[model samples]
Target: MNLQGIAAVVTGGGSGLGAATARELARRGAKVAVLDINAAAAQSVAEAIGGIACVCDITSPESVEAALARASAAHGAARVLMNVAGIGGAKRVVQRDGSAAPLEQFRRIVEVNLVGSYNVLRLAAAAMAKLDPLDDGERGVIVNTASAAAFDGQVGQAAYSASKGGVAAMTLPLARDLAQHGIRVLTIAPGLFLTPLLHELPEEVQRSLGESIPFPKRLGKPEEFAALAAHIAENAALNGEVIRIDGALRLPPR
Candidate 1:
């Protein structure tokens, strides 16, 4: 996958890792589609990259179908799919007062993170399967966003961890399933990165969090994530793998 003149789709391209990915793919000569739930954010990124903006909700089949159709309408079926849309949450099973945690919170996180990712991946892969193979019999590549919390779940991250864990666990099976179609699937479980989630904190708080990384003593950059995703698209042998982009940081149970 040279990425040159090929079509690519990036979910959650409104911000954070997804935005960076959309830009990177466009820079590599891919005709990129920026899909996001936020129309404004999607349009902003899309315009900056000279790509099309398709407002999308990854959790809905119809929504995803429409988005994929729109992307294809603008720039053929995408050979690259970046499943980077997700939500995060933190909650204990039992609150301090001993009340049970709201199940809705857990369900929402899993719905938007795990189910949403699968929804997008399935639809994208189906479209990719119909495309003619490129070099090495490769049709396309998909990169999913998981998290270090999937493995090193902190005390309050039950919902978030479970959702991300599902994403990580499904990598191999999905890759194997898509292999027949010459499509590859991979996941990236990033550690603490300077995503918008952490950007709202005070400067000292952010710095404190960054210092927790064993080395480098700083938060990971979104561009670093984008770089790895581009590499995965180019390296066909890297399928069915979940690469951790954490800076040697194993989150401690809070």
Candidate 2:
């Protein structure tokens, strides 16, 4: 489980939490592969961390295969996979006009967040399974990104929440499924963080959102999320768990 010189794959590593994780992993001596839908961002981060850059579409099987191949070619088979490539959509099940929400909206969220994550995890785990076991019989570790909304979704968050909830719900079972291969799976359900999307909001809006947290009264930093993920990578006893990094902020029902 030591990250030293191990191959690691980080999807959505262009920016936000994934980018932070990639940097931290590199800092911890892991040779990282930065995969993202944004080729430029991926290249930038990879260049910054001296890692490999892979342009990948997590939703496509062919894309995932090619990306992993490139990653492996550059940095051997990955022993760590961070599934952070996801998208969010906000929509209620019904509208005020007595019309149901478009099913496509719901499907897209689940496809990117849930299905995409599973796709990368499976592929990376397979590669990890083939690696010679490290000390303590550990082959690899997977850290999946969920959201606090999965536990306490507000109004208009049905799609996003459902997608994240599926991630949270699958952690233990997936870990069990992969345990025989010496692979560990865990989920990190983060609270509001200063991701690029949220950082684009007005300063006052950002402050108000940060003030909602119970303590620290500010948005969680991307580096903080990375720190927890880095710790999980090294700690073998932490498996099949969903740890929330929300500053004790249980969202309101809105």
How much does candidate 1 score in TM-score? Answer: 0.99
Residue pairs clashing, model 1? none
Please give the CA lDDT of all the candidate structures: 0.95, 0.95
Question: All predictions: root-mean-square deviation over Cα?
Answer: 0.7, 0.8
Summarize candidate 1's per-residue lDDT along 1-254 as a digit string, tens digits: 79999999999999999999999999999999999999999999999999999999999999999999999999999999999999987888999999999999999999999999999999999999999998699999999999999999999899999999999999999999999999999999999999998999899999999999998799999999999999999888799999999999999987
After superposition, candidate 1 runs with Cα above 4 Å error: none
After aligning candidate 1 to the native by TM-score, how far in Å is the CA of 129 from where it should be? 0.7
Question: What tens digits encode model 2's per-residue C-alpha lDDT throughout 96-127?
Answer: 89899999999999999999999998888888
Q: Using Cα atoms with residue i matched to residue i, what is each candidate's TM-score against the true structure?
A: 0.99, 0.98
TM-score, predicted candidate 2 vs. hidden true structure: 0.98
